[model samples]
Target: MRLPCILVLFLGCGSPDQVQPEIKQLNEIPLNIRDKTEVDERTATVNDTLPEGWVDVKSLIPELVLDIRYATSDNFVGIQLYPCERCLLRKEVAEAIAVAFEALRADNLGLKLFDCYRPRSVQEALWRKVPDARYVTNPAKGSMHNRGAAVDLTLIDQNGHEIDMGTEYDFFGEKAYHTFTKLPAEVLTARRKLRDLMQEVGFKHIRTEWWHYSYQIKNYEVSDFRWPCPGQAL
Candidate 1:
């Protein structure tokens, strides 16, 4: 459902109070979108704002595939954030990414945006799908994604095919670990370039998931907001 922005003071580190109660109680949250009417109503609640430089996937970039549900849906078991249709990000980040992609494109490289501006419900959906402490975070707390400052991305070739990253997005295995040093040189270089540019532009990379990054620093808080804003009327 479309929600108002929940105003939260930025905490350097969250308190014990923010710690999720327990995985056992997590089932209290709904996990599936089985009812079409309910799903439609909930989807309507999502604030589909197209931030500057953010393109509507259906119109501007339909060729890109959204494979997020593989992990959360019955059709797929892979853990990944599904693609968002009308979500957006800062124009500056988009420009920087376009420039970086230019460098790749000259050599026949392309960029694939897996997610941006995720609704909190979507985040909670993921939390319920895989509550294992090893990978997914508990929605009872928070996610960088809820802040609208992070993104999960990977590379695509000129032909629109995904480039090999040694492991899939959200793959909780050793291969998906950024510190794993056994990958090929090209894969490492690609990851490094992505990390460098994102860091340069104010995004922080998560160690466990290479594709994920966030602009959670102090200044960029202007862009950081909670999805389904709890306080505001929709």
Candidate 2:
């Protein structure tokens, strides 16, 4: 159940649409989340201020709707959903992405943020879905997704069709491996383009998953403690 990144094929510059209704005020804890009360004690806390150069993407790529919610089988199983509203990353990360989008769009390309700023509580719920020692990270251990730093993303062409990245988002197998030798050269190049562009905008990708990247998570040694998402008025 990875977030939807379905690219649409179209053209011409158009004003961005209103953010999707289901995508906003995403504070309710889905019923299936494991322990709503369990909080990560070791999580780190940060100042409320956003760094410079980061711009909110709500208006930048409004055509690319966000579905940042729990998935029965999203990456890392179910542990990466936003646990609390405020607990997600500050808005600056989205801003940074918007800047990156502006640069990418100049070349007729666009970005699709599959996941961003997850709450630690949602990570706990994800653990319950697949508590296996191999696939999921224990909330007690911490997850990059729990921090505002990590994001799952992909690219879209001018026509809006998503460029093939060799496998579906959150495909949990060898095919999903960024280094899989079986992938074609062209697909690999497209993957690298997304990776390089994100990196240029100050993001770093995880070795196993090319679609996953981080902005500020590299500086923090721990995930953020569960909190709430930013207020709607923001």
Question: All candidates' TM-scores?
Answer: 0.57, 0.61
Summarize candidate 1's per-residue lDDT along 95-135 as a digit string, tens digits.
Answer: 34434444454577666776665656665766777786556
What lDDT tens digits, residue by residue, belong to model 2 across residues 136-195? 458787766665667777888877777899987766676766556477887877876775
TM-score of 2: 0.61
Native-referenced Cα lDDT, model 1:
0.51
User: How does each model score on lDDT?
Assistant: 0.51, 0.53
RMSD of each: 15.4, 14.7
